[model samples]
Each structure stands twice: as C-alpha cells, then as structure tokens.
Target: MTDSQRTALIDHDVWNGGLFGGADGRWYAADQTRDVIEPATGERLTNIGVARAADVARAAKAAAAAQPAWAALAPRERAAVLRRAAAALERNLEDAARYIARETGGILAKAQLEVAEAATQLHIAAALPLQPQGLLLPSTAGRTSYARRVAHGVVGVISPFNFPLILSMRSVAPALAMGNAVVLKPDPQTPVSGGFLIARAFEEAGLPPGVLQVVPGDADAGAAVVEAPEVRMIAFTGSTAAGRKVGELAGRLLKKVSLELGGKNTLIVLEDADLDVAASNAAFGAFFHQGQICMATGRIVAHRKIAAELTRRLIDKAQTLPVGDPASGTVAIGPLINERQLRGVDAIVRASIEAGAVLEAGGTFERLFYKPTVLSNVQPGMRAFDEEIFGPVAVITPFDSDDEAVELANRTEYGLACAVIGASVARASAIGERLKCGLLHINGQTIADECVNPFGGRGDSGNGGSMGGPADPDEYTQWQWVTVKSTAERTPF
Candidate 1:
C-alpha cells in the first residue's frame, strides 16, 4: 500500500456515510455517523453510518419477509448462489485485502490470508446444500423417519474487528447457504472490510434482495440486533464480556446463540521436543497479526530440560520480527486495532514485569505499534500468564514434569485452543487429549484453521457452539424430525 493507494482507500466515498440493507437493495445515509480512524497512522479513514434501533428492526423485518422464499429454493440453487459469491470474493481479493489491512492495521500478509480464508469459507459453505445424506437417517420397521434441517428465519451476525473478514464469513456464509437471511452488525472500527466487502460480494453474485443486511455501529447497534424480535439466532465473535451479554439476552428470548470469545491459550513444549521447531511455532502463534487472534498463544509451558534453550531461541525470534507499517513487505507485527488496546497491552506488560516476570525483549511501543515482546519467568499469578494478552507478547514458563505442564496449561479460565509440541506424535496427541481447550494442535502452531474443521472454544471462551466444517449449519438452523406411518398402524397422532 503506497501513499497514493492509502489516500484513495482513506478517501473512498462509497462507504463514507452509508448503511447497507439488502432488504432495500441499496445503501442509505444514516441520521448519524461515526468516523473510522486508521490505527497505524492515526488518520481518518472514513465516516460510517450508525444504525439505530429502528434500523435494526427494519433489517430484521426485511430478513424475515425474504427468508421463506429463499428457503423454498432448491438446495442446489442455493449452493450455486454461494459458489458465485465465492467467485466474486476471489475476483475482489486484492482490493479487499488492501481494505482489510488499512482498516484493521493487520499486516498485508495477514489481510491476504483473511481474504483467502473467507473465500474458502464461502466455497465450503456451498457444499452444505449439495450433501445428499446430511439430513437423512435410518427408519424403523413401520415408518420412515428423518430429520430436515431448516433455517432459524433470521440470523444476526456480530463480528469483531480482528479477523473481521473470516470471522464474519464463519457465520454469514453458513447462514446464507442454509437459507437464512442475515442482519450483520460488524465492529464499528471495521465496517468496510467486515460488513461492506461481504455484502458487496454476495450482492454482485446476485443474492436476492433482503437476504443480507449490513448495519454498522458500536455496542448499541449490536444490542439492537440481539434484542430484535425477528432474529431467531445470533452468531457472535468478540470478548467474553460482550459475548456474555449477547448470550444472556438471547437466552431470555429463547433465541439460538453461538459465541466464539476470548482465550488464554497455551503452547507446550515437552522435554524431547525440537527447540527450533517449538520456538518457531511459538513466534508465529504469539506474534502473527500482532497477536490479535483469539487463540494466540498466551502462555508457553516448556519442559525444564529444554526451557533455557527454547526461551533463548524465542527471545531471539521476537527481537528479529519486523514491527512497523503493515503495508510494508514481510512484516510480522503491525499496529493494534486502536490506542486503547495498545495501552492495555502496554499496561499488562508493565504490570507483569513488576509482578516478577522477566521482560526478555521488545517491550517498547510507538502509537498503536507494540514490539513483538518476549517474557520469561512468568508465574501463575502474573497477568501475562493468566489473562489473554491479545498482543504480540509471548510468555515462557518452565515446568518440571508433563503433569505440571498440563496443570499449568489448564489453570486459566479460558479453554479456547492450545498446542503441544514434542518429538513423538503419539505422546503429544495423548497429552493434547488431557488439555482442556476445544481445539488443539500437536507439533505445530495453534494459529492454523480450516473451513472443513470445526472451530470454536470451551468454558469462558464460548458456549460450545462451533463454526465451520459439516457442523457449521448447526449454529444457524434447527432440526425437525419428520416421520411417515405405514398404512395407519404406526400413526401416533
């Protein structure tokens, strides 16, 4: 992204002050607007329209009215539309990548990865409707019984700023493929990449009017979506604090809810693990996208035998990671989403150092850019180990035995994801089973995700509602049992 390209993105007038509603098949300027600031440069990117309570209700009503017709389409037809959307995404990949990197302050590589993952998500979701035996089941002697999966009418998708493109698709693509209309409320900080780009792809692919809506705003706008009467399901990805509120509101209304929240994930290196590989994985897990990832490795529990070597390697790795403008070539750490997050990470690093943790390398910050930092001597009570750092800070703590490593890994309140790296795959697999997180990686980084693999978290991380793979539609639909009687003998009603 050159200065001229950045200027063009920042001055783009299409999203300067508009809310998109698939219902009306148009973008409308709102009564109020909010300025979006580029975190890396502290420059005004653009202004976005703020959706009010009434706007959310209108989107919901639009979705509800359009859903039945959408659901009535043959499965193959819906699949075709989804495939077209995927193609559209691919066509817009580079421009979308630029928008994402500029808006989210994520590196160009991470932004490109997000766009590719989103395309994959759309393609994978298209297959849901093509599965021949998905809703079919075995029948008893006198009757034929099966379950048909149906949409939950309207699904409200609320995604975070970090991983905006993929996180939005995790729910949006699946919901649309399953014949559900969507009312999306993206993070206020990233409306363009999160809500606008997605809507544009589907729209250009000829998605029917009212099938998707983008109403971008802050917490108030998100609350409106959650509180809307017509929304039957809510797919949320954010902090545990906000997720809890969404769960509470949805639970009271008996609305289905799926949450992918925070994590204090761990990366374990056993005694026999290769220090080179373990350190490399740790660097990637802890600093990629400046560690804004929900499953970023927060704690590293190394076997005492290899702790010294691994810690030394990790410190060296952090120091070498390029930290600056995300638009630059092959950068590792980028600016955080905002100044608040930058300050928060700074405070955590400072407090952890004061709490007896050793600051090994890279603890400085300039504006929203925080260096990829390494912390050693991290103890159980230290914030660096116990809480989700959500920054480019890797904490290393030595454990004497395998049992101790497991104990330390499971000590945190979150159970989102973790990694165990060792020479023996079987041993690592066994140890992974003993770990408490919902997702685990053996001999690799915890950062990898696939559209065909189930993705979510456990405990404070989520409510066990998963996204992706064959089960993704489960989060956005309901299962109704259908049965037919032979003659009248098997009829119960």
Candidate 2:
C-alpha cells in the first residue's frame, strides 16, 4: 500500500492484504470494514477489515493446531525469536510511535514511550523461558516425581485503545515465550498500532505461521475469543464493566483469565510537602495522556493547611498545558479517543459542578480537545470524586487529618493505584500502607510501571490476577505432575 493510502500514518508496505491475519499465513478478507478515524483531526485515516465471531474462531483453531510444535522447540530457540522481535520493534520505533500518536491522539512522547515499553516487554519475556519452570517432589523408592509448567495451548488477548502497544504486547510476548500460540483481538479504534504492528514484528523475526494471529473487531469478536473452545486462557485490559463480563464468561467456560481493569487512583499531598513538587506531580498524574490512563489520578487528597495554595498552583499548571493535535509534537494534552468519551468526561465535570464542586481552571473543549480542568472542594459523594473520569480533569479534596486522608482515598470501590507525597518517605509509606490499592507510590505519582513488577489491581479493578514479572509463568501455563518408576510394581489386580 502507498503512504497516501494509509493517510501517511506510517511508511510500511505490509498491509497490502486484509487487516485480519488468519491462520493460513494470509490476511483474510472480511465482508465488513471499519473506518479508522484520527481522533485529533476527525478524519478517516484508513479502513480495515472487521472480524466477526466466525473469524475469531478460525484464528483460535489455527493457534491450537500450531501450539504443540512451537512448544516442542528448545527454550533458547524461543528466546532468540523473542529477542529478534524486540530488535525489529526498536528498528522501526519512530514510525511506530508516529502511527500510535496519529491513531490514538496521544502526544508523540507518550507514544514513543509506549513503543519503547513494548520492546522492553519483549526483552523481558525473552528471559522467561530460561528461568526455572518446575519443582522436584518427594517420591517413594524406585520412583521419581516432579511438577512442571506446561503451555495452555492457546491464549486470547483483548487490548484497549489507550496505551495499545504496551498493553497488548505485555500479554502477547510472554504467552509466546512460554510456548503458547496467541490470537489477539485489539480494539477496533487502534487496529494498526495495537495489532498489525505486533504481527509485522513477529513475522519479520521469522515466527512460524499460525503461532500468532491478529484479529481486530468490536464486542462480538471479543465474545467469540472468550467462547472459542480451542482457547484455554484470556488476558483482557479494559473497563471494569467490560472486564466483569469477560471474567464471568471465561469462568463459566473454565478458562484461565487475567483481567487488568479500571481504576479511580488517588494522589495524597501532605502538609509538609513542597508545594512546587506536589503541584508538578499532580499535573503529570492527572493530565498525562489527557488523563486516559487507568492509573491516572482520579482524585487528589491534600492536607487542609496547604490545600488552597496547592490548588492555586495546580490551576496555574492546568492553564498552561497546551491542548491540540498530538501529531504536531508540541501539545502536552491531546484529544480524547472519540466523541463518546468526550461526552462522558464533560458530563462528569458538569455534574460535579452542580454538586457544589468549584471549577477553578477549565470546563471547556474545542472539538475533541478537552482542556486540562481543575475542580476544588470535591467530596467523597460527588461524581467527580466517585466516578472514573478518564479525561484531563483533576479534582482536589481537602482532609483534616491523616486518618481522614486514608478514608477519603479508600472511599471508592475501585483500588488500582495510589500515591503519597510527603517531606519524609517513611512517613508517606506508612500512610500509603493504610490505603487499599494494588500499586502504591511514595514521593511520586500514581502512573508508574516497570517490566519487572507485577501489575494489576483489587476490588472492582481486577480479580487478583496480575501480569509481568513473576506472574507470567502462572498466568500463561498450567501445572502438570509427572511420576516414573525404575521398576515395575507388583499388580494388586
């Protein structure tokens, strides 16, 4: 395809066939095609094939058929393939980042970081196969017994539009490393960056056919992946509402599931904190990526003594953040993914204001570009404090004491991440320990992740299943117990 055909999102020629990669080493055509709209410009960037339930089923069957052979390879062989894939991603990093920025309305820097993180995830997954995969068990005389981790045959990954590259690869690379085939269904809004780019990298790395398939679609496609008989596990990243449905269906089918869901993360600023540092962290935490992150600070709990001054500084910061097309590589804040998301965010801000929260900085937008907004006097019962407004809006609520700060932080049902800013790290950590969240940050912001850390949430956020680091083996494989005898035992029969 020509550059103009793809709307100049990237300079690549691999998308000549259908968008959906099938099991037969060919891109399969579909009856339907969906338009990929650029969030910043509201223009059709490109159109790609849309996979339905039947298409997803075909991919799953192919993955199941191809898994055994792939798993039979030596560990080093698999690791080498993963390392090569990582290198391929690094080689095309700039193009991929530009594609991501144009497609998702994320700034260039965020897109670049996401692509880099995806490569890092591949590198991390490369090392997983070389690690220990089993344990020896006690056995009787003339008998040997052990337990080993074995592939689950096929894994289905459903990724969201926000941070598409990293979220999808975090599951895909690890599953492939553990010797399982994957059928990935990236969000329709970001098919190229979330699915096509991944397929290209692995294909260039010489991965065998049918071992990985990329199928982009909407809810029907996702449901098909969960229901496919050939798939043994599901890794999903999206809203808590969607995640609940995925978990319920996967559970009924007895499929292993890893869910990384929604969050209403909190950032607490103590009375002794440096106002300048606290304000900067607050801006980054609440406004980064237009506040589309699951770990974005939904609410800021500040000590009453410094609440007014902190709010003033936050307003100044919010007013200065430039909002526009991210493709220009100048704006700090970009548009929301779509019109529906923009409406949802606007509704929350209006309702919170109606409930007595003061809109201090911004409460407006031009097209999909929402201004970085600030609201003070927010309380626990208000929508601004209770709901997950996945937009560039920061709500501040003051607390009289440390106990009250912890109470306010833990008020919501969702508990994904929380941050505490204080003069002393030890004191902040002590306060953080009292809050309910899967990830906690001291003297930092809530938005943070490393390749070596287990990532997930609790309560409405997740079902205790995590990704990355030590959780990979358990999440991608099933345990099998084996026993052997040196001599035949006497038959009781």
Q: Over the stretch 340-419, how does candidate 2's per-residue lDDT look in tens digits?
A: 99999999999999999999999999999999999999997899999999999999999999999999999989989999
lDDT of 2 at 452: 83
Relative to the unseen true structure, what is the Cα RMSD of model 2? Answer: 2.8
Distance from true position, residue 65, model 1, in Å? 0.9
Candidate 2 regions exceeding 4 Å error are 1-13, 491-493
lDDT winner: 2
lDDT of 1: 0.86
lDDT of 1 at 237: 97
Give lDDT: candidate 2, residue 295.
98
Worst 10 residues of 2 by lDDT: 1-10
- Residue pairs in candidate 2 whose N, alpha carbon or C atoms collide under 3 angstroms: none
CA lDDT scores, all candidates in order? 0.86, 0.91
